[model samples]
Target: MSENVRAKAQETLALVDEVNAMVLSDPKAADAVTPLSQADANLGEEIRSRMDEIDMTDTQSIISFGSGAQTELQEISQAMLADVRNKDVGPAGDSLRSIVSTIRGFSVSELDVRRDRSWWEKLLGRAAPFAKFTAQYEKVQLQIDRVTEDLQKHEYTLLKDIKSLDLLYEKTLDFYDELALYIAAGTEKIKGLDEADIPAKEAEIAAAAEQDQVMKAQELRDLRAARDDLERRVHDLKLTRQVTMQSLPSIRLVQENDKSLVTKINSTLVNTVPLWETQLAQAVTIQRSAEAASAVREANDLTNELLTSNAKNLRDSNKVIRQEMERGVFDIEAVKQANADLIGTINESLQIADEGKAKRAKAEEELQKMEKDLRDTLASAKSRRDGVGDTSGTSVPKA
Candidate 1:
C-alpha cells in the first residue's frame, strides 16, 4: 500500500479509538439512563403518595400544636390587653408579652395546606385525631406538599436530560464506526488496484483514459475529512457524556420541607421546652417558698400570741397551704406529658426522612450497573471486528 493509504488507515483506526472511548467511558450512564428516567417517573408517583400520606398525618399534628400554641398566645394577649383596660394586671400582662409574640409567630398559615385525603382517610379510618389535632396537622401537611411538588419537577427535568445524553453518545459511537469502515474499505480497494498485474501498455492507457482522477482524488479527500469530523464529534461526546453522567447522580430528590420541618420541630422543642419546664417548676417553687415564709411568720406570731394567748388560725392556714401544693403538682404533670408528645412527633419525622435518603441511594446504584453492562458488550464486539481482516472483497479501504 502507498504511504497515503497507510496514513488514511491509521486515521480511520484513530477514529474508531475516539468513538470507542466516547461510548465505553460512560456505557453505564448511556445504557442505564433510560431506566433511570423511568425510575424517576415511578419515584415521583411514589414520593407524591408518601408525601400525601405523611402530610395528612403531619398537618393534623401541626394543627393540633398550632391550636395549643395559639390558645396560649391568645390567652396571654387577652390578659395583657385586659390589664391595659382594667389597670390591675397591666404589669403582669406586659411581662408575658414577649412570650405571646413568640408563640403567635410560630403559627403557620392555614392557606398553605393540601387537604386531599381520600385513600389516606380510608387507610387510617376513623382513627384520625379530633378537630383540634386535625387543624394542627394540616399546617405541617402544606409544607410537605410544596416539597414533594418541587421534587417531582426536579426529577422530571433531570431524567429527560440524562436520556438525551445517552442517545447522543450512542449516535456518536455509531458515526465513528461507520466512518472507520468507509476508510478501511477504501484502503483495501486501493491496495488491490496497486497489486493488479495489468500489461504496461494497458496500465498506461487505463491511467490516461481516466480523466476523472481529480474527481476520484477529491472524493477520497472528502471521505478523509469526514473521518476526522467524526473523531472530533466522538471526543466531544466523551466529554459531554462524562459531564452528563455527573449531573445525573445529583438529580436524586431532596425535600427541603423534610429537613426544615424536622429541624424546626427539634429546635423548637430544644429551646422552648426547657424554658417552659423551668417556668412551671419556678412557679411551684415560688408558691412553696411564699407559703413557707408565711408559715414561719405566722408561727412566730402564734408563739408571741400564745405567750400573750391562739392555735385555731394557724391550723386553718395549714389547710390552705396543702390545697395550693396539690394544684401545683397537677400542673407540672400536664406540662411533662405535652413535652413527651412533641418529642414523639419529632422522632417519627426523622425516621421517614432517613428512609427517603436510602431509597435514592439504591436507585442510583442500580442505574450504574445497567450502563456498565451495555458498554462492555459494545467493546467486546469492536475487539472481535479488529481481529478479523477484510478478506471479503466487498470491504472498502479508508479514503
Candidate 2:
C-alpha cells in the first residue's frame, strides 16, 4: 500500500481501538448477563459434535456446522412433541416450557416466542412441547452464534492493534530522524559564530593603527567603518548565542519526553496485543463449554477484566502522548518567541543604521550646496572689479 493510505489506515485503526477500549471499559456493560453458564451440557456437546463434522477452514463447511446442529435440535424437539401428542406428559410439558423460556431469555436475537400473547395462549403455550423445544433449540443455536460474533470482534481488534503498533514504531523512527536533523542544524548555526572572526579582525585593525606607515584619509575612514561593522556583527552573534542557549533546554527536554513516549508505545505494541489474543481465546473456550450460569458469569468477568486492564494501559499511554505533544507545541512557541525578539532587535539596529545614513547623506548635500554658493559669489565680485577698471580707463582716454 502507498505510505499515505497506510498511514491513514493506521490512524483509523488506532482511533477505533481507542473508542472500543473506552466502550468496553465503561461499568454499565458489566451487569449484562452471559447465558453460557445456564446452558445445557447436552447443547454444548451436540454443538461440538456438529463442529467436528465440518472442515472449519472451509466457509461452507463451517456454515453447515450451524445448520446441522440446528437440524439435530429440531429433530429432538419433534420427537418430544410426538410423545406429548400421543400421551399426556403431565408436568413434563411444563418443565420443558420453563427450560425453553430460560433459553429464550439468553438469546441475542428476539425470537417470535418472546412477543406478548393472550392469557389463554400463554396458558396453552406451556402445554405444547414443540414450542418449548423449539425455543430451547434456538437458544443453543444462538449460543454458537454469540461465540462466533465475539470471536470475530476479538480477531478484528487484534488486527487493529497490530496495525496501530506498526504505525507507532515507524513514527518513532521518523521522529528521531527529524530530531537529529534539527540538532544538526542548530549546531551548524551556532558554529557560525566562529566564522565571524571577531578577535582576528580586532587584532588586524589594531596592528594597522599601530603601524607608522602614512595612510590616506579614505583608507582611515574605511578602516574605521570596517571596525564598526565588525562590532555590530559581534553584538548580533552574542544575541544569537543567547537565544540558542535559552532554547536548548526546552529542545532537549521535549526530545527526552518524546523518547519516553516512544518507549511506552513500543512496550504496549510488544506486549498488549498478544495478551489480548490469549485472553480472547480463553473466553471463547469457556463460551463453547456451555456450563452452569457461574461459568458464563466467570467468562464475562474475565472478559471485562481483560478489557478494563487494556483500556487503562491505553489511557496511560495516550496521556503520555498528549503530554509530549503539548510539550512540543510549547517548545515550538518558545523558539518562535525567541526568534521574534532577535528579529525585533535586528530590525531596530537596521533602522538606526538607516537613519544615520540618511542624516549623513543630507549633511553631504548641504556641504556641496555651500561650496557652489561660495564659488558663484567669488566669480561675481571679480566680474564687477574688471568692469570698474574698464570704465576708469575709458574716462581717462576721453579726458
Candidate 3:
C-alpha cells in the first residue's frame, strides 16, 4: 500500500513539475520594454520604476483572505460537532411507548370470557393515543423547522465563503502573474546592464584612455558607481521576486484548506443534514412498528398463558365436583356422632329428675320439724304471759 501510494505521488508530482515548467516558460519573461541606448537612455531608472509599480499589499491581503477562510473552517467543524446528529428525533418515543402499553392491557377476560373494557372506554382510549400523536407531531415539526432553518443558515454561509474563495483564488492568480512579470523584467534588466550597457561604457572609457586620462578616469569612476547603484536596485527587486516565489506554496496551502472547508460545509448543508432528517423520520417509523410488535407479542403471550391457567383451574374444579357428587348422603362417621349425642341427652335428663325427687323429700322433713318447734314455743309463751300478768300486778304494788 505504501509503495502504491508513493508511486501515485511521484506520478502526480511529475505532472505538476511539467505544468510548472510550462508556466515558467513565459515568452515575455525577459524585459524588452527598455531599449538599448548604450550610453544615453536611463534603463536603471525604468527597472526601479517598474519595481515600485508592483503592489505587494494587495497580494498579502489576498493570501490573508484565504487564511481567514481556513480559520473559519476550523471553527465551523467545531460547531458542527454539536449541531449535526442522526438521533435527534424528539419526544415521539414516550407517545409510542404509551400506545404500546395501552395495547398490552388485555386481560384474561379478553381471551376467555368477554371483553375487559367497555365500548365507551375503548372509544375514549383511542382518543388519548391520538392526542399523544398530535402532540408528538407538533414537537417533531418544531424540530424539523429548526433543522431546516439551521440548514438554510449554513447554506447561506457556505455560499458566501465559496464566493469569497473564488475571489481570493482569482486574486492569487493575478498576483502570481504579476510576480512572474516582475521577476522576468528585473532579471533581464540586470542581464542587459551586465552584458551590453556596462561593457559598452567600459569600452568607451578604454577607447578614450590616452586622449583624456583624467576625465576618463573620472567618467570611469562615475560609470562604476552608477553601475553599482543600479545593481543594488536590481538585486532588491530580485529579492522581492524570491519572497513572492516562496509565498506561492503558502497561498496554495491556504486556498486548499479553505476549499476543504467549503466542501465539508456544502456537504453538511446539501447532503448530511437532509440525510440525517430522512433517517430520523425512518427511525420514528421503525420505532412505532417495533413498539406495536412488542405490545401485541406480550398480549399474545398473556392470552396463551391465560388459556393454560384456565384449563388447569377447570381440571381442579371438575375433580373437586366429581369427588363431592360421588359421596354418600350420610357418612358413617356422621351417623355415629348423632346417635352418641342422643344417648348423652337421655342420661342427662334422667340424672336431673332423680336429683329433683331427693330435694322434695328434704323439704317435707324440714316442714315437720318446724311444726313441732312452733307448738312447743306457743305453749311456753302462753305460760310466760299468765305469769307476767300476775308479776305485773304484784310489781305495781311493790315498786
Q: Please tell me which predicted candidate would have the highest lDDT against the true structure.
A: 3
Q: Lowest-scoring 10 consecutive residues by lDDT in candidate 3?
A: 106-115
Determine which window of 10 residues in candidate 1 has minimal summed lDDT: 61-70
Model 3 segments more than 4 A misplaced: 1-229, 265-290, 312-339, 379-399
Question: Which prediction has more favorable lDDT, 1 or 2?
Answer: 2
Q: What is the C-alpha lDDT of each candidate?
A: 0.42, 0.44, 0.50
TM-scores, all candidates, are 0.22, 0.22, 0.48
Q: List per-candidate RMSD values in Å.
A: 64.0, 60.9, 15.7
Tens digits of lDDT, candidate 3, 1-399: 123433433343443333224222122222322333331345555435554443322433222221222344445435444443432433323333333343344221122111245588677874434334445544554554444444334433433444444444445444544444444444555566678866876777778758686776776576555545555544554454455445545645544554454444344434554554465456456556765777889999999999999999999999999999998999878999998998998988888888888888888898889998788766665666567576553432311
TM-score of 3: 0.48
**Candidate 2 per-residue lDDT over residues 1-399, each given as its tens digit:** 124433444444454445334311111121221232343575444333432443323434422322322244345436545643654223322333443454445432222323456688677765333344345545554453343333333334434433433333333333333232222222232233235533444445567654532443444454445444433433443343344344434434433443343333333333433343354344434434533455678899999999999999999999999988877545878899999999999999999999999999999999999998878867665665667576653442211
Clashing pairs in 2: 37-292, 37-293
- Model 2 scores worst on lDDT over the 10 consecutive residues at 23-32
